[model samples]
Target: MSTTPRARVGRPRATAGSTQLAPRDEILDAAAALFVENGFAATTTRAIAERIGIRQASLYYHFAGKDDILVELLERTVRPSVEFAKTLREDPSLASAAALHTLAVRDVETLAAAPHNIGTLYLLPEANRDRFDGFRASRRELRDAYGAFAMDAATDALRATWTLAELGAAIIHLVEIVIPLRRDGEMIDAVRIADACLRLCGLDDAAIAAATGR
Candidate 1:
């Protein structure tokens, strides 16, 4: 007699109707929504799996666990700004005011383009843990980019009274708080926000207008 075939083990592949996305992407999308809607601490792997109509074990096919999903989402939220900030730092030809304006506009646009307000994840206590060190490092790079522009704008001792660190923090505030709060429906006027950010960095009206081409 022929032996019966051994039953397949482990989570089955995701069905097309359950998610049109490739399994990994579908899991990331679901995890991002849940992390944004319900704080990261509160969002479980099972909930993420359920959101995409997959078994909890299937989530492991894409991610090791909830923390892996969260770290990936945070990286997606911040990596573009980090990469662009590096470019600005390397390009000596870019003027201080122009660099600041360019960074502000691009950073705000990246934030608005995300599927959810992933920036909000920065507030989660879990984000401070060692596992999220990459996210912290990326943010610091962006902050340092802002500091460089601030220092460049301070051409004289009198003008440099405000610390570069303080000026940099102000720019971060504009991107993280002001622009999002001031959005017109789903659209954020990145140019307008960038102009405001330059003004915060102590650039006069003419300078702001010139840098932003407005």
Candidate 2:
């Protein structure tokens, strides 16, 4: 709804919920878009409330303030990837590093495309650092899962090569790159970038090809 900019906090997972949360999510989603388009300092909860066709006072019932809405936006956006990556990691039948890389590729593309989500997350203020930590921990579960997968693929070289760390950084950096892309008003094409980054992360040409299904 809104595409501006704002501070980013942790993104948690989206779960099965009722229609009541839907309107709240709509408000947060609009706020995130506005935050990405404008900037956190410039964004107004009133504007978000307006975008949702509601009074500013009504917005308070769904979220406490701007930061709370930002956090909700984050949860709506980022949590699914972590959850999905966990599912992939739990599969014992997974054969190659390519599998993990492949799963990451899909998630990376999704993460990269959601610039409003990314921007809002970064706009989170330091005073909100405690909630930020919780957000990070919630999302980190997926990263930890992927790291394990990456390390396993690297012949248990998690520490020796820091494969998990490297891969995790690579994945997150892909998200970070979206920050500027959105600012520049460029095409937020994630698949193209994800392809190249995955290669650099040691996903072989064949694996990348398979991941892209191209």
Candidate 3:
């Protein structure tokens, strides 16, 4: 009866530290900051661990490796918007312009709220590697959703002048301006950006105000 219980064997959880994030999230936040400041290629697993004040092995308990972390981060950049886009698609009550406005606002908020503006890591050449195919696919899904929404929202004249591909790419690029805005410490107003997106598709003020609810 006096015998002590056996200690669990496997990767150990991170000990409490300065960060309020759960151990895995702490690693991601630290890595995002370092990756943005120091460049992804220059950041290492040991460095990520050191930033978290944890052993390198402890990182593996949460992520398989640096690439795993990067993949997860990249996916986080688009997954929410893509899922929301899907939800918007199934709602028939929303007009195309309103749906597009809603989607764009959601996208802006997603990028603006990302931990450490990790969307800045999106251009890393390493992100283009085969290991990141899943992220790339998810991003494409978001892009396609943008394009579909744009086509539906475009005015007759606008549609006649622009292809779906062109309109979609334009909206997504506008939403992504939030990344640089965040990097430069500029303000991010989701409604303003979303309104601009509608304008880009040829919506007038009344239509924009209607769609954007402003």
Candidate 1 ranges beyond 4 A from true positions: 6-12, 16-19, 155-159, 178-187
Give lDDT: candidate 1, residue 206: 86
Local accuracy by lDDT, each model: 0.78, 0.63, 0.89
User: In model 3, what is the error at residue 181, expressed in angstroms?
Assistant: 0.7
TM-scores for every predicted model: 0.87, 0.69, 0.93
lDDT tens digits, residue span 1-214, model 1: 8999999986667643365677888888888889877878789998998898888877888789998888888887678987888888789888888888898888888877666666667778898999999988887778878877867864465255767667777788788763255333545678888888877766788877777677
lDDT of 3: 0.89
For every model shown, the clashing-pair count is 0, 28, 0
Candidate 3 accuracy as TM-score: 0.93
Tell me model 2's lDDT, rounded to 2 decimals. Answer: 0.63
lDDT of 3 by residue, 1-214 (tens): 5999999999776654757888888899898888888989999999999887888889988998899998888888899999999999999998889899889989999999898899998888998899999998898788888888888888889989988777888888899999999999998999899889889988899989877677
Q: Write the per-residue lDDT of candidate 2 for residues 38-108, one digit (tens) a residue.
A: 77668888888777677776677777888777665666556777777767767777654655566656665
Ranking by TM-score: 3, 1, 2
What is candidate 3's CA lDDT for residue 122? 84
Least well predicted 10-residue stretch by lDDT in candidate 3: 11-20
The full ranking of all candidates by lDDT, starting with the best, is 3, 1, 2
